[model samples]
Target: MNITISTFMKIAVTVIVISALLFSVGYQMVVDESNHYDSELDRYKNESLGR
Candidate 1:
């Protein structure tokens, strides 16, 4: 099978776009989970100090 330059370029662009989207989604989820855990920890610390 002979692939032309235009087809190769299209495939490359598609791969790049998909990779960027997956990376962004994974990064956002990590940040959100970290923030949630941090807030929970702070709440626990405050409660312990009050007691």
Candidate 2:
């Protein structure tokens, strides 16, 4: 079996693109969850202080 340079480059590019996309999505999700937790913690603290 013989693989051409063009074919190899195409595969590499595809893998890289997919990896970048997944990383971006995962990073965004983590940021969103962190933000949510931060807000919740702030709310809890405010409630506690009001008592």
Every model's Cα RMSD, please?
2.4, 2.3
Q: Where does candidate 1 have its weakest 10-residue lDDT segment? A: 1-10
Model 1 clash pairs are none
lDDT of each structure?
A: 0.95, 0.95
Most accurate candidate by TM-score = 2
The collision pairs in model 2 are none
Span of 10 residues, lowest total lDDT, candidate 2: 1-10
Q: Model 1, 3-39: lDDT tens per residue?
A: 6888999999999999999999999999999999999
